[model samples]
Structure formats: structure tokens, C-alpha cells
Target chain A: MNFFLGIKIFFRSLFLQSVWNYERMQNVGFVFSLIPFINHLYKDKTVRAQKIKTHFGFFNTHPYLANLLLGIVMRLEEKCLKNEVSQEEVLRTKTMLAGPIAAIGDRFIWSTWRVVCSFIGVAYYLCSGKEGVWYQANIFVGILLFLLIYNLLGHLPLRILSIYWGYKYTNNVVDKISKFALQSYIVKIRNVGIIILLFASFIYSISLISDLKIVLLFWLNILLSLLLSKKIAEVGIFYILFLLNIIILTVTNL
Target chain B: MKLSLWFLFISTIAGLFHLDVMVFGQFMFSRPIVVAPIIGILSGLPEVGLIVGIITELLYVSIIPVGIKIPPDSTTVAVLTVVCSERLIDIPVALFFAIIFGFLYKYIDIAQRSFNSLLLGWVDTAKAELVEQRVNLLIIYALFITYLKTVLFYLIVLPILSFFIKQVFCCWIKNLWVHMDLYNLIYILPAIGIGIGLAHFVEE
Candidate 1:
């Protein structure tokens, strides 16, 4: 029964953002996903309704990392039902865990893993070149590779492991997560992946700029880009480079 | 370079489903990298879509939607760029317009989120009335509103924009392409990508 509940919750958790709103922000979806477990646990309709209503409070987190919170909350709620813990304790657990997990999740998944995968995807797409069926085939392969690697390696495993660890460790879940040092590992892996991908991109960029003057202009743009403070949006830098490209091409006729 | 209603219809629907990623699957089909190429293929120009998608992806690599901060809607920008410019405008020019549209659409996304709060009020009423099923209905309503926003934006915006590109920018792009070394233009894109990649390290 516990295994079945875990399976159900895991599936439901994937839809955690379905009914997102500014006010409560995933509160509805959170409640929705927990409904089956709540139903199974509570015998009385009133108590069940009360349990469900309690979850209607503001709840937001990184959607993938949310499964961990869900599992921990489930354990806390079970204790509450058994009178081993108070209702306030359960609510407090939810509030406390949400923020930290969101921070980690956003950093690891959104910033690191996503950027790494995209760098790989862009590298593949660029190296495939500009024309013919071969290029088209490579584009499709690159997209498929991105989705597969990201979902299989990063998303699905993290979600399942989060749920498992959250339930098994309960209140000590943070310690368990820290002990594993998942964040550091992710950062390390991402750093290596990005370095390799960036090297490939660098070589590709060099090969594309065959003319000497254009190479000088390219290096100038790189230096100029490096000088621009990080406060400026990367998109803005791209536009500047694009405009420079047009001007250089027009003037040099290379 | 005439607009194909068939492509427009398909793109609108795909765009609507893609917006559902925000609320539903989060499967990332809604991402510019994915959606742009799909649009390209549907419009029978997968190569254009793929190239534009790569540039857009690299350009926006660091801009993830963390917490409540909504980034520019690059997916829409990408779709519009690929679909509207098919044979009319140069890819680079189309990309420029798409970036402009992307910034504009960010405000639209914010407005849609604000509008969603009103629907949340309705969900609250349903909960208070003890009509449990109505809560589900409200969730569906929210999803529908999201779908409507994407479809309406695409349907209303794309055709007119395509027309404008055809009339105003086509000749200029054609002239630029004729005068410039195509290799230089092509090389510029990956150069931007490399710069952005290097910048990513700096930001970190």
C-alpha cells in the first residue's frame, strides 16, 4: 500500500504546476496530488476535509524538488494522524523545507543542469552545419538527445530519489541530503561538462572565422564582451555582437 | 512568401499546448529549442527552424524562470521568426524581430498571470461552497485560460507581423544578403554563442 501511494504521489507530483496561481502558487496542485493519499489515510469525511484544507495554504517550490517535500509532508501528516505530532508541526515542516529545497533545486536543476544540456545541444546543432538532409537529421538527433539525457539522468532520477529519501529520513532529510553532497556533485559534473562543451564551441567559432581581419574583430568582440559587467543582460551582449558583425562585414567586405 | 493558413493553424495549436508546460507537464516541449524546430518542420523549413532555435537557445541560456521571475517568451519569438520569415526575410533579420517580440510578450505573460489570480478567487469560492468537483473544474478553467492566451496571441499577432516583414523588411534583407559574404553572417551566430558561453563562466 505504501509503495502504491508512493507511485501515485510521484505521478501526481509531475502536475504540481498545473493550477499554479500567484496567491497560493501551486497550493491547488499540491492539494490535488495529495488527495489520494489523504483519502486513503483518513476514515472520517470531516477529518479528511480538514486535512485537505490545511494543504490549501500557500505552497511553492521548485516543481521537481517538490516531491521530496511531498514525501516528508506525507510522513509528518501520518504522524499527526497517529497523534505523535501536532498539526502545527506538519505545517511548520512544510514551510521550513520549501524555501531551502527551492533554492537548491533552482540552482542545481535550473541553472547548472539546464545550461549544461543546452550547451551540448547547441554544440551538436552547430557542428552539424547549415544544409542538407544530414543537417536536418542531426538537428532532430540533438533535440532528442537533450530531452532524453535531461529527463532520464537529471529530472526523473532526482524526483524519485527525493521522494524516497524524504519519506525514509523524514525530519532528518536535510542531513541525509547534505551527507550525500548532491549539490557539490552536481556542480562538479556541470563544471566539467560545460568546460568540454565550451572548448568545442571555441574551436568551432575559430574555424568559422577564416579571414584575418574578421578573426581580429572576433577577438575584439570577445574582449569587449568580457569587459561588459555581468549586470547587463546576456541577450544585450548578443545584440551588440550581431550589430558589430553587420558593420564589420559591410566595411571589410570579407 | 505568402502566409500559409495551414502552417498558421498548426503553429497556433502547438503554441497553445506548449504554454501548458508552465502549468502542466513541464516536459519542456514549450522551450524555444524544441518548439522552434517543430514549427520549422511543420512549415517545411526545418533547417531554418533548427538554426534559429540554436541561436535563441544559446542567447537565452542563462535566463531560467527561477521562483516567480518570468523570463521573455522566447518560444513564441522563435516560432514567429521561423514561421513568418520562411522565404521572405533573412534569418538574421527575422531573429532581430523575434527578439523584439519576445520582450514585448514578457509583458503579456505577466498580464496573464495577473488575470489568473481572478480565476483563483473562483477556485476559492468553489472550495468554500463544499463543491469539491468544482475545484477541479476551476483548475481546468485556469488551464483553458492559459491556452486561450497563447492561441489568441499567435492568431492575432503572427499574420499581421508576417505581412509587415514581407512589405517593410524583405527588400532590405535581400539586399544585405546579396552584398554580404554569407559565410561571415553565418559565422557571426556561433561567435555570439561562444561569447555567451564564455560569459556564462564569468557570471558563475
Candidate 2:
């Protein structure tokens, strides 16, 4: 019976809310959070549905950002749904919070932290070799750490902030945090230099042993990019590369 | 189940890096990623899986389900690529084969829409039946059709292509192959241009 209920929730979350309302992605995150509690609520369908809907409100998160959004929304949704808040009030709370959460969550957790963790993982793999259980554990642990801290910071603020200043206040808090992070000195000039260095090195490395006249490839790339920049959105460069690849292979007998 | 297993694996890896770009790690296991990878992993090499993933990812990058415009069927590309790559009896054949495979994937999506129409018809009948069992049956049928669409795509198309490529195609005048280094260069130039374009022209 419990299993059936769980499946029903999964199906509804996945199909009904996701498809009909066209917000299925968010519902999937909500269902993921509710999965643990689901097994415990075997007999009570009413409470199960209520609890699921309550959490389902946190749904708008990107898949990778799911944990953070899930963590925060889970806490915040519970409070808002329980209050005598109007529907507009509820929605206003969600909209205001979602963008701010998305910004901080994207920058710190998704962009910066993920880069750091992946770099650490890559370094570990390079240094220690990719074979051992330890390496595997390190990779797994790195990912888990990302999920943990991201979700914790993402979720924890809602509880404290919502309690103190209502839901809208939490949005400003998230904004301030994001603004501070973005404006940090490290994000200024040095980051620009690093980006330039990475690109130059990347292109130089690619120029090695390529038969298709490096200059031609270079020109085509520039032209295509110029087109892309001008918003002439179409598949140009890829097909050009394809045609050029065929011509080069034919001529060079490669 | 076999098809689904394939889809999940392929999509997971493909979506892993790229989806990180936009959603910044959100919505990885959604429809396109889920479907595209399923096709590549099941029948072709990981390279094919990766290629198909990249192609579909780029194709769909600007398309968001913000309003109408249901995005093109990305799963079809994976499924067709795997099928063509296996059947065509060539590893580094023209990228044209990929375009062909991509086109075929779109057609299969048309078939899916047809199937959806039939399923909707059944949903109406079930509603009319006033029997709760019909609702359950309809749900089961929908699930079955989703699985069926993915499996039949590989099982049917791959074997036929494999036979045709192996028997008929000849290795004549094969030369214009782009080296991997050049391929990397081709990919990178745009990033540099974009960087330059944004920095030089566009005001932040």
C-alpha cells in the first residue's frame, strides 16, 4: 500500500503536475526531497499528498541546483503554506526568492564551488592516479561536499530569514550575498587575465598537427563567430567544418 | 527497460558537463538529455554517445520551453546516430551521416506525436468508462508506449542500417578527415571570438 502511494506520488509529480501545469522539472526536485519521508508515511494518503504538495512548491530549481533550492524551498514552503498568507503573497514570496536564490546558488555553488571541487578532483586524479578506491572516494566525496554545503547554505537561510522578516526579506539577503561575492576583488582584473590565458593556450594546443590549413580554420572560426555575435542564429560553422574536413581528408589522403 | 537504462546513462553523461552551463547544474535528467544519451550508449561507442550529446546540446542550447515551441526531439538524434554508426560500417565517415541521423530523429518525434494522439483518445475513453480500472490501464499504456518508442527505435533501425552499410558501401576516395587537433581548434576559436566580441563591441 505504501509502495503504491509512493508510486502514485512519483507519477503525479512527474506526469500530472509536470505535464499539465508545465512545471514538471520543479516537481521532480520536490518529489526527490519527499522521497525519504514517503517511505515512512505508508498508510496516510491524505497527509502524504498534503506534505508532498507543500514541498512541491519549491520546485523551479535547475537539476544541479536542485539540492540547494530543494533545501531552501522545503523549509520556506512549509512556513508559507501553513500561514494564512494569500495566494498572491505565497507566489510573491516564491518569485522574489527564486531569482535571488538562483543567482547565489548558481554563482557560489554551481559556478565557483563546482569549479574548485572539479579542479581538486582532477588534480587528485592526476597526482594519485585514477584507479584506486581512494580516488573514487575522493571524487564521490567532492561531489557530495558540493551537494551538502550548497544545499545547506541554500536551504538554511530561509529558516532564519523567513522567521525574522518574512519571505520577501530572504530575497534581499540572498541578493546582498550574491552582490558581495560577485564584487569581490578576485573577480576583477585577474580573472580576466586567467580567462585570456586559458583561451590562448587552448587555441595554440589545437593548432598542432592539424592538416586543414590552420589559417583557414582560423578565418572560418572568426567569420562564424562574427555571425553568431550579430545574432544570425543558424548552423553555419559546424557544417562548414564538416565540408572542410571532407575536402582536407580527400586532398591529404588522411 | 533496456532502452530506458540506455537513455539514462547516455543522457546523464552528456548533460553532466553542458547542463552545468545554463541551469548551472539544474535539470540534468530532463527529457532531451535523458533520451539523447540513451540512443548512443545502447548501440554505439561512448564517442558516438558524446558526439550526439554535444550536437543535440548545441542545437537545443537557445531553445527554452519558456512558451510554446516544443523543442526538437533530441533523443531521436542519439537513437539515429547510434543506429547509423553501427549499421553504416564506418567510424570516421562524413559528419553528413550525423546530419542524416539527426533528421531521422526528428521524424521519429513525429511518430511519437501520433502515438500521443492515440493515447489521448484512450484517455477520453477511459474517462467515459467511469471505471477506475480504465484510468490505471490508460496510465500503464502511456508508460508502455514511452518505453516502446525508445526500444523500437534502436532494435528496428540499427539492424537494417548495419546490414546496408556493411554490404553496399565502398571505401573509395576517403581523405578529407579533420584531425582532432583541428577539431579542437575549430571549437575554441569561437570562444575566443566571443570573448573578443563581447569585450570589444558589446558594452556591459
What is the two-chain DockQ of model 1?
A: 0.51
Q: Candidate 2 lDDT, tens digit per residue, B1-204?
A: 765564455434443332222222222333223344444445545444433433343333333332222344444444445545642224334233444554565455445544444433332333322322333444445445545455555555555554455454434322212332323332332332232232222322
Question: lDDT per residue, candidate 1, A151-244, as tens digits?
Answer: 8888888887888888778888777778878867776866776676666655555555556665566566666665652656777877887787
Runs of candidate 2 with Cα error greater than 4 angstroms are A1-25, A28-61, A66-69, A76-88, A99-173, A183-207, A210-219, A222-229, A232-236, A244-254, B1-94, B99-149, B160-204
Residue range A18-55, candidate 2, lDDT tens digits = 21123322443345334443435334555544444444
Model 2 lDDT, residue B155, Cα: 54
The CAPRI-style docking tier of model 1 reads medium
Residue A38 in candidate 2, Cα distance off native in Å: 9.3
> DockQ for each of the predicted structures, in order?
0.51, 0.15
lDDT of model 1, residue A121: 72
Q: Residue A35 deviation, candidate 1, in Å? A: 1.2
Q: How close is candidate 2 to the true structure, as a TM-score?
A: 0.50
